[model samples]
Target: MNTIVSTYNLSKYFNGICRVNEVNLTVYEGDIYGFLGPNGAGKSTTLKMLLGLIKPTKGNMVIFSKNFNKNRQLILSQTGSLIESPSYYEHLTGLENMRILQRLRNVSNKKVQEALHIVRLEKQQNKLVKHYSLGMKQRLGIAMALINFPKLLILDEPTNGLDPNGIREIRELIKSLPQRYGITVLISTHLLSEIEQIATSVGIINDGNLLFQGSMEQLKAKNKAYISIKTQDNNLAKKILLTEGYKFKQNNDRLIFEDLTDSHIAYLNKLFIGQSIDVIRIEEHRKSLEDIFLELTGKERSL
Candidate 1:
């Protein structure tokens, strides 16, 4: 895959401390690259460096194959972004806000209208931004980001202040960008579940370090596999599984085997049937991205 964005040994300093240390990133065309980390994990700092809003202390950053530091105008023309909260004139209507951005980007009013349609904010185009809910404001932010029809869109926590419906809307909007508009996206957020649903690839960062970078499927596959089996005699099945030397976990009435193969499962089913133990259900339990992240990061998260 050809890289649309690449960073080499990128480092940023704040008060002589490395905020983002020796990082490398690759974002390909037509990819929604999820950049995920906890709060204060240097996500914003790295984005600023990439956008040339802040100068890097060491290493190089390139966008669209151009060094952002040297070709700032060229990069800006091809890219659109919403970093942090997008602020608009409190008194301005949604249309007005988009018009201002379009003017600045040297784009047409039709482009602004198209962007509003993309974010599903066309009906609220005449409403004052102050009257818009947080979710609406986020949609407007995305509208502004799309006003230029940029080849690459950088969104920092695109669903930060959205409600469930708004989050769903944004997720659909992001997913449609590559196919509908031929736009690639690089989105930064701490919401792993959201990333799992929308991103084609992900880069996990923590404590200013890039821990892992790969597809969500690849990350999920890194964790151990487990086979879940439900039987009439839950306790007896658990006992049999343990006695048979299968490493397992108990989920409600189900006994899950950590390393059980198809043949092993079949054998267990036959044994249970012979013993008059009804086999209720059986399946391979696939680990989620969150499960893999917990194992890799060694951190516990509560719902």
Candidate 2:
């Protein structure tokens, strides 16, 4: 796939404090790239730099295969972003609000209508902004961003304060953008479950550092499988495992070890029975994506 955006050693410092430190981000065309992190983990700062809303203290960015600094105007003309919250006139109708942006971007009224429809706000376009629900407000923000029919869209924590139903609506709209409008999306959020559902690629950040970045399958594969066994005597099992050159963790009466194949499991069962050790039960478990996300982010609970 074509590279839509790439950053090298991107760093942002505020008042001599590093908010984003030596981070590299890669966004490909047709990808819903999920920038996952805890709150205050520099996600917003990094995105602001990408949009040129703030300058990076050091490092470089390339957008659409052009140097972003050299081609700022051209890049931004094709890029749309809703960083933080979008401002709107509460008394104005959604359609009127969209028209203001249409005039600003010099786009036709058709683009405005198309954006509102894509966000499923066509029916609510004539309603006053104050009458719109939280979900409708967010969709209006997105509609404003899409008024220019941008090729790349960046959203910073768009689902920040929505309920379950609202979240689902936004999630569906984001997931459909790539296929429907050929737009590449870079969305930052604290919710891993939402990322797991909507993102084709993932970037995990914490403490102003980028910890992991890869495809969703790669992140999911980081979860390791383990075998937990209960025996009549766990101490004996530990000793036997140690004597047999195996590593394990013990908790109370249970012994846990890394994943063993079916053949290895059979061998262990036969060996234990031959040694007159009565086995209780052995169960396999895999670490969840949430667990890995927490471990990587040091239990920062923005999610």
Candidate 3:
């Protein structure tokens, strides 16, 4: 778990406002680190600084133990990134674009072919990039990133415009990168389920501050056992459930219990029956990544 990247008091300011505060973080080897936040939460800004696309107004940034300013070429050679929407030469064939990128990086032609194969774009190598579908274009962008055979891959919303099938394909591809190619990944996205499915660890940010950072199991453990109790008298069930010292919230016609042990739930069932409440159903709910995000980020939607 050696550090692949580290930041000390990193801050990015635009027009005298700090978009990225004095944030410190570390990324370990072979990790699929999820950077989660809302649309304007400085996630992309922080990544730009990490990739040296934008300079930090304060503090220092390091990649693979090399300071970004002094050793950028050395560090960037082993790093690949696709930030926001990737643009490619529309008229150039996929293979031609790859060849151009390889020549620019001084990577070999064989490496170019290998990268195309890795992203499953070899079959369409002769097709012009503009003719490719949204998913195909995204795959080609990924192949371009892989051409360098980077030790670290940084992607900003890698699956943004992908279909469900496209999303699953990229999901599988990303999950295989660390173990198969010995590459570490830093991915940012607003999609919680995508991160939950693939990321080994996560860092949640809001208003330029780190809200939570840990393994998936640790984040899931933050909330107590969730139970969904459905009854015809929804209001009564909610009132009774809350009165019994069980913290609960209302979801449609159901009462969502935040913390309730088995015995307490059983007693609740008995009490509801005695009170002439017809119980429709009682089921335990699994707290999803969205639930964890909302809990950590204060249960509010922010633009």
Candidate 4:
């Protein structure tokens, strides 16, 4: 796949404090690359630098295989972005707002309707921006970004303020872009579940530092699976597990084992039965994306 966006040792500083440090990011064509991190982890700062909204303190970036420093205009022409909340003329109708952007971008007027249709806002194009609901406004913002039919779309927290249905709608739209329009998407968010659903690849950052970057499958492979077991006699179960030298941890009223085979489970069941200890429950537990995200970033608070 073609490399759509690439950064090398990308760093940003504010008031002599490094907000982004030695970060390396690669986004390939046709990929929905999820840029993930906790709050104040430089996700937004790095995205701003990528969009040429702010200059990096050190290192450089390349977009569409062109050096950002030298070909900023050329690169930006093919890139469309929405950072934070979108700005709009409250008095203008959706169509009117699109017309303004069309004029500024020097693109054909037909693109206005096309963008509106893509965002499912064509029916509401005649409505004033101020009257639009939060979800409608967000779709309008995306329509504005799509008016140019950009090759790469960068959205920072696109679903930030959306309700569950709105989030689902946006996620579906974003997931469809690569297949329907052949557009590469780079989305930044603190939500791990959202990334797990739509992103082809992900980069995790924390405290201005990059922690993990790879395909979702690779990240999941790093997480160990465990089995939770509950027995009628917890004391006897513990003694049996200890006698067998099995590695496990006690959580509340259950014992968890990281490495347990089907045969091992069977043997344990038989052993318990022979000893007249009832086995109440036994189940395997796999780590979720949120679990891995929290562990990798070493943060207790939710994203």
Q: Which is the leading candidate under lDDT?
A: 2
Two-way lDDT contest, 1 vs 4, winner:
4
- Per-residue lDDT of candidate 3, residues 8-61 (tens digit): 988989999989998787789999999988878889999999988999999898
Clashing pairs in 4: none
lDDT tens digits, residue span 1-303, model 4: 899999999999999999999999999999999999888899999999998889899998988889999999999989899999887898999999999999999989788888999999989999999999999999999999998999999999999989999999999999999999999999999888899899999999999999999887888888788899899998998998899888889999898988799999899889988899999999899977777888889875344
Candidate 4, residue 267: the lDDT equals 93
lDDT of 4: 0.92
lDDT of 2 at 261: 88
Scored by lDDT, model 1 comes in at: 0.86
Per-model TM-score on C-alpha atoms: 0.83, 0.95, 0.83, 0.90
In angstroms, the error of model 2 at 14 is 0.9
lDDT of 1 by residue, 136-189 (tens): 898898888889899999999888867889899899999999989989999998
- Note the Cα lDDT for every prediction shown: 0.86, 0.92, 0.87, 0.92
Tens digits of lDDT, candidate 2, 256-297 = 888688887887788788888999998899888999998999
Q: After superposition, how far is residue 144 of candidate 4 from its true place, in Å?
A: 1.1
Task: Write the number of the candidate with greater lDDT, choosing between 2 and 4.
Answer: 2
Where does candidate 4 stray beyond 4 Å? 230-255, 275-281, 300-303
**CA RMSD per model (angstroms):** 4.2, 1.5, 4.0, 2.4
On TM-score, the candidate that comes out on top is 2
